[model samples]
Target: MSEGAKLTVQELDKRFGDGDDAVQALAGTDFSIAENEFVTLVGTSGCGKSTLLSIVAGLEEPTDGSVLVEGHEVEGPGRDRGVVFQAYTLFPWLTARQNVEFALRDEGLTKSDVRQRADQHLRMVGLERFASARPNELSGGMRQRVAIARALSYRPLILLMDEPFGALDALTRQLMQELLTGIWEQHRLTVLFVTHDVEEAIYISDRVLVMTNRPGRIKAEVPVDLSRPRSPEMLSDATFLEPKAQVLEAIREESLEALE
Candidate 1:
């Protein structure tokens, strides 16, 4: 696993089934993410956003094209990448510390080392105090935090997030956004995040890639010219809204075309 890994996707394509039943999920998709860069992909529902993400995670193979992480073509799932989903997949029977520890125990760490690592990440997510609480006892946001801590426990090269905040309420979603950005910066982790909310995409990403409706392809790249250390204040300012409108318009046009 290379630190602050770079990703390259070229002419990516994915198809399912065959003949008349064939469904092309992604077509000629191409993009590059710099090491430590925070990039977000947004599109209409079923536009292959999740499918594309899964390919990058090596959970699925692209029907065409290639994915290279730090110049090496990805073969299959590797320890270099960590994936977090919208649904919190923590174990209800385990305490928060145990949940994170479970992800580390398989990494060859000693029991005491695993405990220390779990402590470190749970503290990073601001849940060290809740270490004894099970997923059943945590709020939706906290559960997601535990999921994040578990994913990072392995210290992977990049974090692949698929709608990780989509399940939270508006207010909690905003808070999680703030927390995630901080964690990303502190860890200096390369992050590829997927989301449907246009505003959220602009607010959190260094660049946003708007995708066309299914058989999805990159439609537009909006560089979020906003300065770093972002805050909710940026949302109401031109720095954020301009790029938000650009990304939103790109998606809107693609979405309309899909319905036609």
Candidate 2:
């Protein structure tokens, strides 16, 4: 693990099945995210990107190795880490505000405190007006906002997201990306995001980790050198294009090999 890393994965490995029919999904995967740094993982399909994220989220256990947050090994899901998935995992019966409050149920806060925190986070995500709306009543983007607010309600040290905007249309997805970056800027929490969108990874990440196919491992780490307070216009600028091309080339190589 690197010094002062907020989260660290050391020699991680994961496999499923047994004997001759076994399948290996990851091998010797290692990386670290610094405090308040934004890191994204990109890889070809079925390269175990989600698997790695799951391991860090403590939703799934690794076959070997460990994940440490602030030098403490992660044994299972805890309040220290917040998770947002591609699917909006909000409870159907509850309104948006209630959904966020549900995450704080075990936080041992007063009812008024919980309600205030839920409203505050919903406002943070630009959904204060929709607080009373149920999941079925909200748009795809709105639902995701509620999900993000819920994940953030408890103030986790690390935010783990897996393609949280993947279900939206292109326009909605772009808007969601911008929204996420804005929230990240304001909150300044360590973020480990997994996505298949090369441009999205470049636009939002301080460092992008590219992984190999099948039994995945970090194949390359591409650092985004674009100036912060990133604007949409910068996406087409030379500085952004340079790193974008590098990340794309790395993924293309692994993608091509996966099709072999």
Residue-level lDDT tens digits of model 2 in 69-151: 99999999989999999999999999999999999999999999999999999999999999999999999999999999999
Candidate 1 wrongly placed segments (more than 4 Å): 1-5
For each candidate in turn, the TM-score is 0.96, 0.98
Residue 20 displacement (Å), model 2: 0.9
| Model 1 per-residue lDDT at 62 | 92
Off by over 4 Å in 2: none
lDDT of 2: 0.94
Error of 2 at 224 (Å): 0.5
Q: Give every collision pair in model 1.
A: none
Error of 2 at 141 (Å): 0.3
